[model samples]
Target: MDLQSDLPPLCVTCGVCCTDAFFRYSCVTPEESARIHSLGFPVEREDGREIFSHPCTRLCGASCTVYEQRPATCREFRCTTLSALEEGAIDRPEADRRVSLLRAAVQAVRQLLPKEEKIWALRARLYADPAAAPQTRLALLSMDILADRYFKLKGRRFFS
Candidate 1:
């Protein structure tokens, strides 16, 4: 049996953890690195470790295209929401509602920023200069707060 089959179904509908919203990169072993590279994904070496940036290229919407061959980090990491669901602490509908809210917030932030811009870069630009226009600053702040709430709800930490 596939171990992933036992995981909460919400994982297939939530891509927050894969979008660089929670983690900047996913770490991989040398073998996994080679596999990802062979699959045409861009991999980076940092501190002697292989890593892939978030908004992972293999992510197709809310699911991973390389699910069967995903890196260990991806396979092992579980958000609080998923844990809760697995333990029957929250029902599927509740999990879906939470994921939907997070997805809407993410979409709102994407709409507010340039289509090609990375979220971390936009966040840094907003943080580096407080002199940005009030509206822009407000939008960034709102996005930050929403992101924080999403992370908190997922039982994860917002690294920013």
Candidate 2:
């Protein structure tokens, strides 16, 4: 049986998790770190944890170039919508709709911020600056709310 083929096409079409749209970095084990580094991707230490930063270098336009050799963190990570879909808590169409909403939200935030700035960092900068535009604040809040509702697991820190 081709189990992989039987799986839904959700993840292949939605690579937000592979980018800074969700996380700034993914936690990696020592072995996975070494493997990822060997694959020509850099692994670094952050706050005493081994991690690979995102938007992942291996990601090429929403597809992972090193997917077959991706780290444990990458292989194991699942967004809330994916989990809901796999658990039959929601149907594929709903899951896809959620993904689409989150993507649009991310795009809106991107339009308001610099191309290279991670959402988390920019969020902080914006929050700290009282002079920040209300539209930018609204975009960030909308993105984050959608992210929390559709993607992120409860208490799952993006820095993780």
Best by TM-score: 2
Q: TM-score of model 1 relative to the true fold?
A: 0.79
- Model 2 lDDT-worst window of ten: 1-10
Go through the candidates in order and give each one's C-alpha lDDT: 0.71, 0.81
Backbone clashes, candidate 1? 0
Clash pairs of candidate 2?
none
- Residue-level lDDT tens digits of model 2 in 1-160: 6554575467766888987766778887876666777887777888898887878888886578887888888788889999998898988778879988988898898888876788778877887997888998999889889988988888777665
lDDT of 1 by residue, 1-160 (tens): 6554566456667877788555678887776767778877788888888888878898889987777777888787766666776787877777777788777767666676777876677677777888865665676567567556434545555542
Regions of candidate 2 where Cα sits further than 4 Å from its true position: 1-8
